[model samples]
Target: MLHRSGSGGPAVVFLPGAGLVGLDYLNMHNRVAELTTTVLYDRAGTGWSEAAVLPRTAAEVTDELLELLRAADVPGPYLLVGHSLGAAYARHLAQRFPGEVAGLLLLDPFHEDLHARVPQEVRDRLKELESQERPSPTEEQLRFGRSQMAPLFASWPETVRDQLIEHHLRVAWRAGLRESENVYDEVAEELRRAPALPDLPLIVITALGRDATQDQLWSERVLREIHCTTRALHADLASSVPRGEQRILDDAGHGFLHEDRPDAVLQAIADLLHRVEQ
Candidate 1:
C-alpha cells in the first residue's frame, strides 16, 4: 500500500507517526509532489498495509521501508519527512544506510535519549500513566473525536475523509498505541546501539503548544517539563550533524503540527531539499 506522486529524483518520502497512515499527510504530500517525486505508504500492520505484529523493531521497520522503496523503483537518496515514531525509524534508516539518504525533516520526533534527558519524576509519572488500564472509547467519545477531526480533513475528498475518520476512530488509534508499546524499552535500546547518523541536511521541528488531549493526560507541570526537555533534546539532535538545525513552532501541538502549520512543514521540506540539492 503505497502511493507515489510527481516525478523527480531524490524523491521525498513521508513517514507517518504511530496511528497515522501515509494518507494522513496528503496535504503535505500534495504540496511536495508539485516540487519533486513524493511517496506516501503504510508500514506493515498500519494503515492500508498488510497486517503484522505490533511493535516491530526499528531494524524491521527500516528494512521493510527500504524493500518497499526498491520494489516500487523509487530512486534515492531520499529526503525523509518523519513525524513522531516515524522519525525514529527515519533516523535508523539514515544511520544504517547513509548514502541512500539525502536529508531528514523530523517533526516532534521521538528520541531514544528521551528517557535519560528528563527528570526522574517525569519518567515515574509517565510510567504510572502507562500502567493504568485503558478502556475503549465510548460512543460519545467517538462522536466527539470525529467532529474535532473532520474539520482538519475538510479539504480532502468527502469519501476519503469519511473513510479516514471512521478508520481512525475504529482502528488506527489503537494500532498506534500498540506500535508504541516498545518505544521505551526495545526501540530505545536498538537506537542506542546503532551507529551514529552520517552528516547530512537535517532539520528538527519542535512544537511547543499543548493540545486538549495532552492537557487531559498530563498535568501542567509535567507538560511544561516535557516541552522544555523536548526542546533541549531536539536542539541537541539538530546540532549532532554538520548541517543539522532546529525550528520551533510555539502555536502548534505535537500531533497536529502538519495540520496546524502546513506552511512551516513545507518550508522545512523545501529548505532541506535545497540543502540536499546544493
Candidate 2:
C-alpha cells in the first residue's frame, strides 16, 4: 500500500483495473497527492501484496477496502477513482456506502449493459480481447511487453518506471482470469439491481477512439463505430446523475487513457474536487 496524507481535504483512493494493482497509477496519484491525501493499494495477490483466497467476490473486495481504510485510519469521506473493471467496484462502494464516498471519477469505465448496446462487430472485438486462450506470459512476451511499455513510462523517473515494469511483470494472469470469470458478471448484475447513485459529484471520462488516427492495428472505421457506440453509453451514464459530467477523449483506447493524456484525467479529477469542496 502506498498512501500519503496531504494537508487537508477528503482522501482520494484509487481502484485499479483487472490485472493491474495500484502502483500502475503512481504518476496520477503523485499529482493528486500534491493537493489531497491519496491512497493507492494493491488488491490481494497483485503487486507487492500477498495472495488472497480464491473466488474473490465484489462484496468481499469492497469489504477488504473498507477494512484496510479503517485499520490504516484513513478517514472518509473519500473520492473514489476507478478504471475499467475497477469502476464497478467504485460504483458498488458509492451505492452500498454512500455516506463514505463524496464523489466518483470513472476513467474509461465499463458499463454492465455494454454488450447489449454495442454492435455485433464491436461485441466480437470485445470477445477477442476477452479470450481465455492466453494465460501466463511467455518470456519473450514479457520482454516485448516491457519494451512496448517503456515509452509510456517516459513521464516518470527511471526508478519508478523500473519498479512499475517489475510489478507489471508480476501480474497474476490466471488469478485475474479466475476472478473475472467468477466475479465480474455477478458484480455487474448486482450494480444493475442496486439503486441509482445519489446526486453527488461525478465525472465520467470516455475514451472515444473514433478518429482512427492512433497507432493501433484496428481499422479506423471499425474503431470509430465501436467508440461511437461506447460514447453514447457514457453519455447515458452521465445523465443518470444530477451532477455528473462526461468528457470524451477522441482517438484514445481503453485501460490507460490517463497515461496517454494525464492532463485530461487530472482536469476531470480537479473538476470533481471543485464540486467536492463546494
Full-model lDDT for every candidate: 0.91, 0.77
lDDT by residue (tens digit), candidate 1, 1-278: 89999988689999999989998999889999999999999999999999999989999999999999999999999999999999999999999999989999999999888888777887887788778887888999999999988887899877689999988998998899889989988998888898998999999999998676788877888889889999998999999999999999999998879988999999999898889889
Model 2 quality (TM-score): 0.88
> What TM-score do all the candidates reach, one by one?
0.96, 0.88
Q: Candidate 2's residue-wise lDDT over 139-227, tens digit each?
A: 99889988877887777777667887756665544555555764436777888887789889999999864322233636667666667
Which pairs of residues clash in candidate 2, taking residues 3 or more apart in a chain or in different chains? none
Model 1 CA deviation exceeding 4 Å by range: none
lDDT, candidate 2, at 8: 63
